[model samples]
Target chain A: MSAENAAGTPPLLDVKNLSVRYPLRSGVVEAVRGVSFVLGRERLGIVGESGSGKSQTGRAILGLTPQPGIVAADRLRFDGIDLLSLPPREMRRLRGRRISMVMQDPKYSLNPVMTVGAQIVEACRVQKLAGGRAAKDRALDMLAAVKIDDPRRVFGLYPHELSGGMGQRAMIAMMLVGEPDLLIADEPTSALDVTIQLEVLKILDELVATRGMGLVFISHDLRLVASFCDRVLVMYGGRIVEEVAAARLGEAGHPYTRGLLGSAPRLSGSVHPLPVLERDPAWLA
Target chain B: MAVPTPPAAQHDRGLPAPPAGLKAWLTSPAPASRTQARLGRFYRGWRGFVRNPAAMAGFVIVLLLLVVAASADLIATHSPTVAGDLRTERLLPPGGEFWLGTDDQARDIWSRIVHGSRVTLVVVLLVSVISMPVGLAVGTVSGYAGGVVDAVLMRITDIFLAFPRLVLALAFVAALGPGIENAIIAIAITAWPPYARLARAEALQLRGADFIAAAKLQGASPLRIVAVHIVPMCMPSVIVRVTLDMAGVILIAAGLGFLGLGAQPPQPEWGAMVASGRRFLIDQWWVAAMPGAAIFIVSLGFNLLGDGLRDVLDPKAAER
Candidate 1:
């Protein structure tokens, strides 16, 4: 971490302590609790089960915690701009322009009525990046960049017309069109085929390497994160239970991390009835 | 989208050529250009609409109304309101120079009914134009904003919706003074609440949709999100409602005209003609019946077309 910090250059994103609470009729339900991390130009993965606050944490960074969800933090800064206190109008300019998040389920994330090219073009031109023809060309180029074989033909297709993997790639293209510094991908490849997943990861890898983009990859697949990201954050009970280098994930000291690791089905194992993760009350503390 | 045929499948001869001409061009599996794609979409919807015979009848009736309204001047032989030789021509049976017979004032009933199509068209167009936007904007904004805004806007919509449509329109016309323009305003005011309610329901479902969230992530403002994202989703339903409501609007216009609160003397409004001819109904049945039948057929046309449109345009019905 110390070796990667260049002199006089701030990290692309910095979070001191961020918490998100959804106030319900019953009571306030805390979704993310005191999670803090700094992201440079490298891939960071968040591994957690559903309802473990992983997706909410990513949403908080993008200021997209759906209405009625309250967010607070000591400091949430992106490229030196105070995200916690920035005016909404200013925040909007930064949101998809400097930072963007890829949502789960491309079927729902992409507009059903709009053709793929129009949506991608909208993503590019939303920041006043380009107009009409140039934005359209960039959209087609982005589609091709995402490894779509026939970009022009696919561009005119609607979201429902595309297969799952193609829809996911189209969504990724929409997010990356503006070349944001930080990209938070939430379960991006969960709907994809294994081969398509690898192809998509290769696209993400290329973007991170060539564009120096900071990535927050959130998925429950621990092994995939370990193989793909440089650093990994393990979340449980609305908090970060462990943080470790992707290479040393096998050597993680935390019990929860080990439990998750032990629970995954291994190719070499003859073990039946894979280990069920047990709850520890103290982890919430 | 076009896949190559396998050698074994060659017996099919490359999926037989599309249809003969226009249908072939319009329903092409892979449209060559944007215009073709749009037309293809429309052609498919048109085909769906053509399947229902009742809806086709209604569609034809509406088409006839439009043509008749547009060319009323050319179609009506005599002036709609001009009276001639009252003692000799008045209340003549359906024959000779007066196909639908003469009215109490010796005016041609057929000419008047033909000309009255223009009045109906104007009322329908003006009412929809004035009210659809207002209802859509209010309902969409309220639903998207939710919370206090939703409650307030909805309560206001409730107040408007509580009144019986014709009663509300009648009250408005009585206050604004009797005339066709005021009648249209009254009808428009009464017509929008149902649209608002429909739009609000649609917006509620769409407000939490992922595509809307995606638009927000793209930094689209609330106004843009509502206008661009939410409104389009709600449009199919709104359009269905508009078509359905056209019947109601026309009814209210006729009701107002019946009460003498719309389309004063010489206007040739069907309802106004009915009102005047009702006095002579015993001896001159066609005088009142012709205009009344016109009202029934036109209203039925709108209702049938509206129902058929739901099957073609409403996403829920379209899915079914």
Candidate 2:
């Protein structure tokens, strides 16, 4: 934080007191409450359980919260543009060009009928970044960067034809082809095999490093986040309860985070019984 | 049952393996050519169609009718509308010059049945052409947009569906006056609601799909999303519905013709042919029976084709 501030460079994405609420017949469910974080040209991990509002926070930043959900914030800015007050057309322009999202599962995220290359080309085309042959070349290049050995063969394949690993790579290729400034990845590798997961992470790491883009890596795997991210935010009961450097995650003082860490299975140590997470009502408030 | 020998066992004798890259290329599951892939798809579709005997029979019947409709001039022995000699040729039985015999008006019944196919073909084609686009547009817009738009469009569709298809077509034809074009319009109007409902249901299911959301996040316009993403996905089901509905459309068109609101006098129409021959039904059974048989066969063809399409197009059915 000191090094970033000393350089006098504004964060790429800045958020203060962000909250997301969904209205239901019963009452309002506060999916994310007063969560705040700042992202620079580095990886920021948000780790939490399924209902801890980590994914909601990522979606709120992109203005992609589904219907019946309302997003309110004291301030939300992206590269000096006021995202909260920006017009929808302006917001749309900002999306995919400046900020892009890679959703959880490529199986459902990629268009089933469209060829992989066509979908990647479309992402570039929509932003007016490239078109026709140029878009095709850029898409092929991005596929190669993702380590797809034969981009030519994969270019003509439907999503269903590709394996789980190939589909995720295509999805990543589509997202990164636009050369967006900020990327939000929501549990991008949770659906893949262990080896494939490592390969995907390596690709993400290389792309982020070379491009110098900000990344919001949302996941529930505490160990993966600690190893991969520069900073970590632990969310619980719709709010971030702990924010620490990834290296210092072991020293986190929050009880919920401690409970989560304790529950994780260890390789060497043998314990008679595994610990379970216990919730407290005070965390909600 | 005898067990087949394993490839590994068969290759027990010392033999040199093929070059690595060549073996990989040969063993690769990719199709050799685009034509090969298309042929594979066609073969699978054919296999599925043949499995259902009723559908195969229906397909054959439809194919025969299509041939009859396309080559009406070459097949018919005489001009469909030309009247025979009233003094001698009137109400002749099935034998002599007339194959299916002459009607009460002395026109060749077989020629009338053959030429009537052209009218039926036109009605089915025109009705479907008009109805499908309108229905797809309405349904896609209603379902994708949801909320107020969905409510309004779907309610309108429900109102249309409330009436019996024939009764609605009859009413529309009654208002538009008697003619082939009017009959087409009437039937098209009555035919679109089912397609709209089907398309709407499909769109609703797809509206929240991850691909659609991804497209939206890519800043795709609403029109682009509906057209590129939503429409293509909805097409298989819509196509199945269209095939099934063609039979209904044909039946309704014939019904309109029977009520004197389609094809007019002197023109051969199956339903009108049946209606005119009813007076002489006991005396000359072939006149009504021939056209009735034609109607029954064509409708059966459409039904079978629709069923076959459903089995092939649906992935779940394909797995079974």
Candidate 3:
């Protein structure tokens, strides 16, 4: 809590007028349109529906937009460096070492052919952190840090061999092994069961608290985001419709936010039918 | 080495009359070291390979090929190349002093076939060694590096694929001049396009996979991603394909030899032997029939092995 950040110093990541567009034969489909936000060393959640560009925003931050998807941001800066102008080689050097992203599905994110330990060691060694035995030891330490009971046994395991929770933890370990300053987790716990979800979240929570790492937690679960994130950005039709403190999420003035809240089936309220969200034409504007 | 005690494992929950020593070691639920893990994986693949009867037959046949190629000189009763008492031995049928009869030159058929196994082995080995690497490299790079690189490499692959393999190989032999080495080179050149195609297809599938994306996000260079990750996933299929292709390679080598462009006279190349035997095909069937049967059996063996390997190594098959 006492770690210093002088007043005139920039935030960990600064994004202004960020847009991701995919050119189809028919027309240009703007996935994220003029979306802008800044992230400090805090847990910031982006909540949206399936096509709501939360994942794209996270990917765009790390410059992981797929080929042919044009990413344009007026000022996309990370740790005082201009991410927009950074060459691929320099971007690659910055990735995993200074900035890392944990993809949603651990099943797919972890390489099936490689052992968990080998993947972790690769992420570590490629950053020029440690070599040979030391890198291996560091990887093992990371697995244990994620609260995996038997790091040694799991290290030799292929991704398919591990259950969902274990694989998710191993994914986290691989991401955190390089010790990046900013971590972008894209719906990390969606594929996991309820109990496993909490465990994964706890691990992420601890890392953010102890290591002072900035986290962009992208998920659609309003309640989960409200409980976990310090602040929330509600995205609609590729734009930020509402931004509110996590505690005041219920009091958000946006009709879309109210519709999203109204749609959820609450155990306490004995409502016969859940309210469906009304499609708004003006949110795109 | 002293036998170390087993580490307490989570998998040891339902232990009822546990296994001991060798069986226990082989059946060990969790391997302690990297060597153990690799050996265990290989051992499992081997187990899968041997389970099917046809694959086993093919494996045995390939083994026979190796043994025969290795000790060709020791097994033969007479000299393969040197003519002996042409008056008595010429055009003799099977079950005489000569087995499988003699060629027009009065050389022993059995001896020639035995010695010819050596040539067959060399051609197969040389072709595979040269072709698989080339195909794998081109395919993986092209697939992983998409866009211009992908387009350019694929077009080049398409050009190679457009040619009929044997005709292209024949053309290569014509250009390079005839010899066993040149024939093998030609065969190798024709052989790699298919592998490159196969590898590229696999690379295309893998390049977009979540694991690859994860690696990309984590700063893995394109070369590292292609070689380390994409190539290995493509390996199981490549290996299966290569085994299958070996049969084709053997046949191609024999075809070149039959055309008199492969091994020179007196070397006992199977295809050349078949060519010579074809002269006396009507009356003296054993001369041609023997070499023809040898080629058929060897090719069949390689094919059976390849089929069995597919059952074991094919990822899709593994799921079933």
Candidate 4:
């Protein structure tokens, strides 16, 4: 990472020993434990199964963990600002304009009634950027950037009118419209078909490279992560068990990582049953 | 139903397309597909509603009632309250200029019913204006915040709701003393809980949605999130509640008048007119029937409008 990009100090977002716990009516359950990472102006992928708290870690860093979910960290900094200490009012300013998120399913992520353009316009207008006409111009430009053929028409169409791929593209457009420095894409392409998945990933790649943006791509598919991301953080049982460059995934040292890799079926594999994961209690801690 | 059309399918259509320049793109609109070409999309939602048998009947009834109320001057020749000792026209049946006949006091029953509708509409609208905002505010905060705020506000609503609405309104009027304004206030206080409950449930569902979280991430203030995202989405349900509540308010206002807590005797109110007409019902049936029919028709109209609205405005329903 360039020193100038990192502001002559730590990474753009640095989370050291972050933990999240939920205090339900009955008892407290730890969701994330001792999860730590440093995000630079490049793609960092966190791969984990659903309950492993990869999503919680993302929310905690953004100071957006839903209420009753306790988040504590030794240090959580975004662009050198202490994230854990910012008031809600200040955190809000940092949220969409500086660090935006692309949620999993565009079906639920986008508001059903709002048109794609209006939702994007809302993201821009919330930052009080260019008023009516300029905002509309920027929204159309962003929609075009996402490869939407007819921005003018798509601008007036509601979420249900768009296909899953188009919705995700619109969501990406909305998130990027504010020109955020850091983008968190939580399984952005999982809901789409394989062809659309490639299209979406390509779009994200273009945005990240062209804008010099830092990306935290959260997903469960290790293959996708390894293929697209620069660095991969393999998480299990609410903790990041291993971190490796994408090129060194085959040479990964952790037993759990190896187990996950072995279990996934290869395209050229012979007619044999897929390998199953073997649990190790010590690996969880 | 077949291979689903991707959003890009229209790009390759062989028809002469607009040039991909600013003016051409701006001036030439996309060709409308079959669904878009249908004129159903352009009609006001109310026109769609009036096509339904029940809603159409309701619309006609409500419209007729409003017209009769507003144009009372043209419709009725005599004053409703004045009891000129018309010893001759007293208790007369439907005949001559007095179509609904005359009361024991020699007052015109048709004229009274016509004028009485104006009062009912006024009270219902006034009470609704007073209480809808209060209910919306309380319900939204309670539902969105949850926990202590929710529990405390809900308990208060429950306390109010526990009492029979009519009796509570009666008690409030008695405490505040008998008058139209006091009656409106009394009716408003009794009516807000249902709206609060409906709004709270709607807000609870809305609060969990991802766009709300998205709005938060977009730096939208709490008020903006509520106003722009949450409230507008909640409006269809809120509208249904308001329409439903209008009937209840009218009923309560009439009940208050029945107890002599509404418009004074000289002024025409359906309930007060009915109360006065009751003493002479055996001989003066027309006196009770006209105003009674007015109350029933107007209330039924609002109820039908509300139910029809609930079906038409729903986004899921609209898709079908």
Pick by lDDT: which candidate is best? 3
Cα lDDT tens digits, model 2, A1-285, are 621555677779888899999999999999999998888888999999989999999888888899999999998989878888988888888888889888889999999999999999988887789999999999999999999999998999999989989999999999888788999999999999988999999999999899999999999999999999999999997899998899998998999999989989989979777788988889878
A1-285 in candidate 3: lDDT tens per residue? 111356868888888999999998999989999998888899999999999999999899889899789999899999889998999999999999989988888899999889999999998877878989999999999999999999999999999999999999999899988889999999999999999899889998998789989999999999999999999999998999999989998899999999998887777968766577997988888
Candidate 1: residue B51 Cα off by (Å): 4.5
Encode model 3's per-residue lDDT on B1-320: one tens digit a residue.
23443443224443332334544655567755455556677778888887888999999999999998898889887999998788888989887688888888999999999999999999998898999999999999998898999899889888988998888899999999999989999999999988898999999998889999999888999999998899998887787788899999999899999998899898899999999989899999998999999999999999999898888876688777
Q: Against the hidden true structure, what lDDT does model 4 obtain?
A: 0.84
lDDT of 4 by residue, A70-149 (tens): 99999999988998889888988898899999998899888887888899888888988777999999999999999999
Where in model 1 is the C-alpha error above 4 Å? A2-6, B1-51, B314-320
Please give, for every candidate in the order listed, the TM-score of chain B alone compared with the true chain B.
0.89, 0.88, 0.86, 0.83
TM-score order of candidates, best first?
1, 2, 3, 4
Error of 3 at A128 (Å): 2.8
Best by DockQ, which number? 3
Candidate 2, superposed: residue stretches over 4 Å from native: A2-10, A278-280, B1-41, B315-320
Q: lDDT of each structure? A: 0.88, 0.88, 0.89, 0.84
**Which portions of model 3 show Cα errors greater than 4 Å?**
A1-6, B1-15, B18-56, B85-88, B312-320
Candidates ranked, most accurate by lDDT first: 3, 1, 2, 4
Steric clash count of candidate 2: 0
Please report, as a residue range, the 10-residue window in candidate 4 chain A with the lowest summed lDDT: A1-10
Question: Of the true contacts between chains A and B, what fraction does model 3 have?
Answer: 0.84
Once model 4 is optimally superposed onto the true structure by TM-score, how far is the C-alpha of residue A220 displaced, in angstroms? 1.2
Give the best candidate by TM-score: 1
Worst 10 residues of 3 chain B by lDDT: B9-18
DockQ of 2: 0.71
For candidate 1, the docking band is medium
* By DockQ: ranked, best first: 3, 1, 2, 4
Clashing pairs in 2: none
